[model samples]
Target: MPELPEVEGVVRDLRPIVEGKTIAQVALSETVFTSHDAGKQTIVKNNEPHQFERLIQQMTIIELKRRSKYIFFQLEKDGETFHLINHLGMTGAWFVVNDITEITEDKFRKHIHAVFTLTTGELLVFSDIRRFGELRFIKEIEEHPPLLKMAPEPFDEDACDFFITQSEKPKYRNKPIKEVIMDGQVISGCGNIYATESLFKMNIHPGRKTNRISRERKQQLFQVICDVLQESINSGGSTISDYRSINGGAGTMQHRLKMYGKKQCLTCDTTTKSIVIAGRTSTYCPKCQR
Candidate 1:
């Protein structure tokens, strides 16, 4: 899945190219995206794929923003404003190209589901092999169910306080720290990979009970989480699998990983270990972390 850093990288790479540009044309596959709701499966945004193609035409992109792992595009049409929300689930990605002709030559086009042709003759394409991505044309992001439900961004001023408060909650107190941090409602954008790396840096065992952590250590953990996420964003995020920037560039953060997928500890000579926490594989240094 494309986590915070990866989504941040995509947002950074896209702002310059897409902002202020008018949508000249829109093309969408029959079933571009899918979602699950109360035991029922449906297309994203409760609209047919073609509806997205119609809603975005002639609209100018005002700004691009990210909340949690979701990307938002502020749009203006005839002086009216709206928003487009996108979630790059699993293998989803956005690719920028000079012309639509080049899309066929790019490997990402094999799964191309949506294409936005800009007035400048450039193209912004959304490709998702698994069809798990999300696309919604929303009038207000603040009221949207998904965006409204997300916790504060890691960079928010009250992030540490939020994490501590959420940790002390009865529902989370006995949960493993790794699982606690990975919960999007507690702290948005800390996925499995970043969660493992941050815990390793904080020298906190991934399996430690959330309530067992001291207030000082909680603050330290929060700081390390910010550090890990910012560093990954600086390195363009980890490309352990299909993640890539808008320019089709692979992220370099994967090479800088200390414990996420390593067999040896970066701080000591002891061998690393792996365990499943909250159904995700977590790798850490036994000696260094705890």
Candidate 2:
């Protein structure tokens, strides 16, 4: 799945292309993409963009922000309001094209799931072969249930609060730290890949009880999550053999991973093993992580 870093990269690449441009087209080809906003009409070729233009043609993109793995676009008007939200689940990607001709067969014919044409003549295309991504509009951004339910993100105060709460939660008292972190309610944006990487980096056993971890270990774990997330963003996020950035480029972070998917520890050259935590495979150097 595309994590926070991968999604943030997409937001970065999309800002200049569609920031000031009006919506010439809002076309969605997949039904699953509508799951983000209940009852949103599936965007066909000619239906919604005209209506969308009446609603938001001259409006400017005031800000672009992210919550967890979801990218939120704050579009503003003096008298009207609308928000654009995007979620790239597994195989989703965005494409920026100066012209429709710039959109290649691989981007349009093969994987294209949605397209948002900007007034500037540029095309912001969304493609997800897995049909797990989402593009939706909302009246008040804060009213969206999914976004509202999300805990604090990487740098927010809510994240720190969530960390402390999760550490004390009775349900997690005997559960492995990996399982604890994998729960989105406990820590948003931590998918299986990051959960494993975070645990390995902190030298914590995946099966260790969350409540039993030491204060030093908690501090180390917190910093590693931030470090790993920032590093992944710099590398455009791990491709995970599926996701790509907004430029349709594969991420390079996978090559720098220390623990996940390796048969041996790259840092210490110790033999590694995989263990199942909450039904997901986690790899660690038994010698190092214990």
Quote each prediction's TM-score: 0.91, 0.83
On the 0 to 100 scale, the lDDT of residue 180 in model 2 is: 77
TM-score of 2: 0.83
In the range 138-220, model 1's lDDT, one tens digit per residue, is 78766577667678999999888999998899999999999999999899999988998889888899999988899899989
The whole-model C-alpha lDDT of candidate 1 against the native structure comes to 0.84
* Candidate 2 lDDT score at position 193: 78
Lowest lDDT block of 10, candidate 1: 34-43
Residue pairs clashing in model 2 are: none
lDDT values for all models: 0.84, 0.72
Tens digits of lDDT, candidate 2, 1-290: 88878888888877766665566556555453454245453432222543543555556666777778887777777756678777876777778877655655454347676666676767777777776666666777566566676667867756765776777778776788888777766677788777778888888888888877975677678778878888888988888765777665777888888888888987789899988889888888888887
Give the runs in model 2 whose Cα sits over 4 Å from its true position: 30-60, 104-109
Question: What CA RMSD would candidate 1 show?
Answer: 2.7
In model 2, what lDDT does residue 92 have? 72
- Candidate RMSDs in Å, in order, are 2.7, 4.0
lDDT of 1 at 16: 88
